[model samples]
Target: MERGKGSPGKAPRVRAILAGGLVLGVGAAITLAAWNDSDFAQGTFTAGSFNLQGSTNGTTFTENPVGSPATLGFTTNPANLSPGDVVTAPFAVRLDGASTYDATVTLSTEASTGSLAGLTYELTQSEDFGCAETVTETLVTAGQTLGSTPASVTFDLAQGAGTDPGAPVNLCFRVTAGAVVQAQTGSTTWEFAAQSQ
Candidate 1:
């Protein structure tokens, strides 16, 4: 019987591979354990009731101890505000408290007689206080329906690590559309909400 040549170091090679794989697995587990944190998802402030349209916009929206500060505001009437007979309002959103959590605020409009192509939004925040962040819309839809208005907008915030514990932070916004020749019009409600990851 002829003896076949065998790789004498085959067993050692196999052992080395297995050892490397085990080390890598343990290292991965350790890395995961070190970085896994649930606190990052925890919210420091309880969420307050969201008012899509409050006393802000054309007027001032003061903050009450029980209510969250107004981030957006505006007014709308169903009969006169919309291109047709639809109702919509102005809007804003709050970037509030510790900017740790993220949020998206929106404003939408009622059905219109035409398209809202030239409309845009501008957001304003107090330069002295809370950096009152304001954002304006870039466009507003005209052909859309009233009850389905998308005067909506979203925001993502990263509050610096050292913001105040609980201070009144306000983010205001305004809207203007159309040209000097065209009748710039849109109707919808303003909304502000905070969502965290």
Candidate 2:
């Protein structure tokens, strides 16, 4: 018997127990590190387009932008002037086929030169292009002085359905000369401003 020496079989059993403990520790560490997964999301954004167009004959529509305006074809010759004379014109407005938004249109008058004094005008929305004596929807009240901007008069327009141009809004402009209206060359311009809604 040797002093301070354990049995060989007992030493082998102790080493086996230590190896088993290390294996268990490694397994517990792997179990603590759990599996993980993730999810992601995204989005896209864009802006819509809008445009407005006008027509004088209600058939040939075009962009009547500022600086160059469409000429209204008056039923009576506007060149000739007489006291107590009245003339009428038909103008149409609508959203272009490419427009994507509806709009509210406001009517206003620009400054005039010569003979515009003592002349009064009225604006009305009509069913047809013909601006007859009969009126349907009065936009600007009668007796609005020429070259003076009237109070805010607004109307609505819808965007076209499926790429076709929106339905036309027919407008009638009636101008009358006062008894004392001057006899000279004059010019007046009106604006139809549209705001998208």
Candidate 3:
């Protein structure tokens, strides 16, 4: 409105409105420091809470006693097994025959992945036969029938030399974690095998 002596549009309109309000307050402080550095990078990584309950420090585990048994390098004497020795597995195990000869046992229980879904625990496997045998081994079938939920299972027992003098075919697995273990994702380990046929 003045136009001239002091200036029309006072000093170019206050230097273009103070350089557009100093570039809008530095673009709102660079958008609030890029949104607080993206919320500290979305709270950052995770995964450090475990309770995969499953253990056996050793009372007796013929094939897998945590360290010895040649660390699964069987040469024989897998508690003293003899009869062509053709036992292989990762499915709970069992076998007994050491009084003499006439034994047959088979165990099976495998299949699981990622984190062993819906895993509950209570496992058992035992054996110690090394003196008598005479046609006594029943439990040739009960292959595989799995189910998982909150998780619960009951296994059967076999290996009977009909009232002889050979008693050491044993396998005792246990896992009473309950509540689906609460938390455990990796190796709740479960390797097994039984022989003598």
Off by over 4 Å in 2: 1-34, 180-182
Q: Please state the error at residue 117 of candidate 3 in Å.
A: 49
Q: Estimate each model's TM-score.
A: 0.30, 0.82, 0.23
lDDT of each: 0.41, 0.84, 0.34
What are the root-mean-square deviations of the candidates from the true structure over C-alphas?
Answer: 17.8, 3.3, 20.5
Candidate maximizing TM-score: 2
Instruction: Say which candidate scores most in lDDT.
Output: 2
Model 1 scores a C-alpha lDDT of 0.41
Between candidates 2 and 3, the TM-score winner: 2
Between candidates 1 and 3, the one scoring higher on TM-score is: 1
Off by over 4 Å in 3: 1-11, 37-137, 140-197
For 131-156, candidate 3 gives per-residue lDDT tens digits of 12221332322222122212223233
Per-residue lDDT of 122 in model 3 = 29
Error of model 2, residue 14, in angstroms: 6.2
Cα lDDT of model 2 by residue, 1-197, tens digit:
55446576488899999999999999999988887788999898888777888898879889987689888888888788687889989999999988889999988875466767667888899877768736678998889887776688999999999899888899988888776444567888888888999
Rate residue 174 of model 2 by lDDT: 87
